[model samples]
Target: MYADEICRMMVWSRGTAPATHDDAEHGSDPLTREWLVTNGLGGYASGTISGAVTRRFHGLLISALPAPLGRTMMLSDLSIRVVTPDGKVYQVGGQEPWLDETSAEVIDLAEFRLEAGLPVWRYEGAGMVFERRLLLPHGQNTVHVTYTLLEGAGPVRIELQPWVNFRPHEGALDRPVAGPYALTVVEDRYELASPSDLPPLRLQVQGARAEFRIESDRLRNVRYRIEQSRGYDAVGEFYSPGRFSLELPVSGSVTLVASTEAWETINALSTEEVQRAERKRRTRLLLAAAPEVRSGPPAELIFGADQFLITPAGRVEDAARARAGGDEVRTVIAGYHWFTDWGRDTMISLEGLTLVTGRHTEAGYILRTFAHYVKHGLIPNMFPEGKNDGLYHTADATLWFFHALDRYLTYTGDRETLRFILPTLTDIVEHHTRGTRFGIGVDPKDGLVRQGEEGYQLTWMDAKVGDYVVTPRRGKAVEINALWYNALRLMERWVRESEGDAASQRHGAAADRAKASFNQRFWSEEKGYLYDLIDGEQGTDDAFRPNQIFSISLPNPVLDPARWKGIVDQVKERLWTPVGLRSLAPGHPDYKPKYFGDLRARDLAYHQGTVWGWLMGPFVDAWLKVYPADLAGARSLLAGFPPHLDEACAGSISEIFDAEPPFTPRGCVAQAWSVAEVLRAYARTARSAG
Candidate 1:
């Protein structure tokens, strides 16, 4: 059975082809289908497969500042022109004129595929072949564009004009770039500085004779239709400091490297060499995290898991550890195309992204990294981009941290880690028992965690639009209490293992009380499942939601085993789709059908009825827990995500899907927990098959 799944998953090697456009509609919008490549430092190069920009985030060099601190869009596009020996000029790669318009297929695009996550575009026509490839080095901000000339394609000339920008990823530039760019043409290279402080961006043409035209021009009114629909500034302006025209030889390759400071080192290496080095580096890291490097289906998942692991800026303690020859700090970005290193995402993604992948060193670093930022016993809900301190609004990110760390210890038996984070764990328990941010505290009477505030969405179902807080699961949300009960149990076990007698006694008593209270209030004998939450904006929100899965799915199950099957059955009966579990059941009046339109429309559907891939992990966990004897059922559910890997973002899982029939992948194209949770569930399901 595993072999069959592995055989089916081999589609990742060929990847998905770019959808052809017969019209300018979104169904045929070239920019609607995108591809991305990241440097483990949180920097990435992403654009449509047709080489068009659809979002402000599209760019060739989105540099990871200092160490995944923030991202900046530097090189917007490299318009490529190819001249055949017969004097016929071919604009194989240009801005919207060539990227989107079907009339621009004069070059006759032959093929496009993601070879090892690298986007490759091939154009063949008029007895000439032009192939464009894009890759970002493992830990560098450089975007390498390689043009390989096939034999018999005739000797030709290739010109590259780079559109440069210096701005944040989310912003748009409507005016011309300010003066004093300090453009320079040196021996065999062209350099330009957007700012005085940032290193000069080096442009190198490998082995081709270069003619530099030192000039500047603004390409105005470059519109992003996707952003327009999202109700954002859709038009932008870009300035190119210069262009490079180079003479090429048949059967030869020329690479243009756009990078800061690394060009001096990378200029000597060919594009093939860089790709080979990157592949080797990625394989090493992937293997380090996942020792199970068998030629099977999970290999594709391991590849997906590697996308979220980034080398973040080391703190003072991390620098000290590095100086002492200890491991460097690392964290998981929540998703691609937008999200930063979120605390809730990192903690929830820990097991599958790190532990199951055999990344023990990174697991230790990630746990410690978040522990360093624990404020008042609450881990941050989100670590805002470009800053050190994080926002502490979550009622569950702190609790999720406990579950993540406990799983880490279970997988590695790292006693040293337990001892190290003991104080922080103790503080979390005490703070939650008393109170933390976002009105989060353990009720003294019931010992269950209660959290919620007017106008604040504290749980994972967080979606807000100005004054409207979507899914404001106010008090005693089902999943928060489940995580709360699990965290207490984890603390009790950690204390016992670490030989903290007094702490163990205290945590044990707390865990027992929380579980007793959880069972008493959460279960609904009439509904045959758990209540979604108590004391919602109204009274108790008995609306069927997948959140109840956690009561049985977690490593530390809080509900009685006798009632476990009922929760799983309810979720499977109503919320379960072929893709994932819906946030809300279908019969509810508030349940939304699809996630689309502007901010308000999207947010309304977000937690109301959108399907979440991450939820499947818990759903599967609950499935197996209730029916440990049902391996077929577990395997059947695990098969749901493989098709999704190819749908939106090749080789990665999407964050959420539409709730109605014909579920379409939506939200982030590559989400961390989406991929991680699916991988984690796959492992558990596979274990039962074994």
Candidate 2:
């Protein structure tokens, strides 16, 4: 099963090293490259290839706690030290203190690679070779750290020092978890519990002899270098319960299971069995995808796409509500490290992550899950971390919901689910027709939906800092109206099917009015592109932003076909980059070539000129509309992404990048929509070209 896996192996070798020795390759620094492993309940383990904890979010275990607590980091790190028969001790992981000049250094990190979606590292020292692999068992809040003596003499003594912390994953370093932590041990198994309502962290060993030594202490001033560079509170303090000593012989192996789950769940499967099951599960995902995309970049994305589709375990109420309704609650986490499930990102990513991957049942579950949360004619803009209820402030996510449903119906021909949710859809359209929260409604004057309110960021360009909305886009946003027109057309068609044309006449007439108004009002005669927003707070915004691409990209394009070529060409000439379309054109006065610095600085440039990886999906759709025969050209536009899977976050895509050359990857390491849109676009092109 593993022999022909396209993205299964990524080796980083220092130089002309042996087949067993792997380090950074082609001057590509492994220190900057990161790897992630996720449990289907919104819990994950992530860190740099160099073994440095660059973010507070990096941990061996970040468990998802049911509502009001969210995700909590239970295990910060576990450093390994190897002592051979030759009486030599070497630090195998990395430096202890992030920036301590005198800290013991990692002697020889010979190699690093991803073997079957697992992060593996090899170290050679003391005439022996040691290899370590990390895995997070599916659907459980546990992480398995397995060690193998790939090449060695005999009888090597290994010391494992486990550091612990109890805090919200997004906790600040200033408020360190000063706790009276308790450590309980019962002959080979250990449990570390906090003073708060958080659950205990269980630790156990398998496949080797082990001993636990009680050495309670604190590792202070451990700096997260990446966070420091981002102008955040980078210094953190962690608690240590003790150390474990284990022995391994030639070709021997050992496994350490660290989890917050109960003992039964933790001991449910042996480490070997768990590994085999996970591998088989990933294989099934690849097989489910379209035949043309069963290998290469698309194959890797099949795994990447799976990382975002998770059960909302933290939102217990939502889960109960869903179960009562005979459905499961599945949603897409917007991105890794910080983002929760957002309505817009989920709907935008649904087709790529679920339908295209051929997990139609889970796809239906995700849509129905979001449907259960629809309120006030709006789907949730986002669910706040640690909270059960969602915040309904967006103007576009609900409309995108309609588009997602249309895609679902087109793919599965499932009329049953549509019939079930038709009332919800009808209610949404009615609310938009009259009005909803955040000043979102159809303007009778032009039949275009307008959205905005002081102190609110309604559109996806939404970036607010300290009560200041960066790109408020408080008006009839081009994409919003395009989505509006699309939604109206879909509603018209759907109502006609469910009922008759007489019953859908209102929706049909509304669609006609919106389409006419969209073409007339959005087209910029002099600029050769659509206006970013019409009837804005400060009048019309003629910004050359990528937002206008949606005018021709949706299933039901609002823009007239006569002007598509001009829009596509203008976008390609001014906003196009190999990685993605620039949010704002380079020549715009507000354009910032780089996205970096403190929160305010990053926010200002976020929607101004940052290159969004997800925008490539829309650009390809628009491009294909303009030049239907240029499938190769459309495929070439995505050439920059295949190599990118090895960067930022190994085997996944980034949220955004710098607008200029080098195009540094930024924002969340593994973004849901970034992987979704790329996979969606690549598969679409492959299907058309084939």
lDDT of 1 by residue, 64-171 (tens): 775333687878888777767777677774336723323433554556665545567776666677777788877777889888777445578877788877777765
TM-score of each: 0.92, 0.96
Which residue pairs come into collision in candidate 2?
Answer: 12-23, 13-23, 22-111
Q: Which ten residues in a row have the lowest lDDT in candidate 1?
A: 3-12
Best by lDDT: 2
Supply candidate 2's per-residue lDDT for 488.
Answer: 85
Candidate 1 at residue 403, lDDT? 90
Model 2: how large is the Cα RMSD against the reference? 3.3
Clashes of 1: 4
Across 368-423, the per-residue lDDT of candidate 2 in tens digits comes to: 88888899899999988888888999999999999999999999999999998999
Supply the TM-score for candidate 1: 0.92
Top candidate when judged by TM-score against the true structure: 2
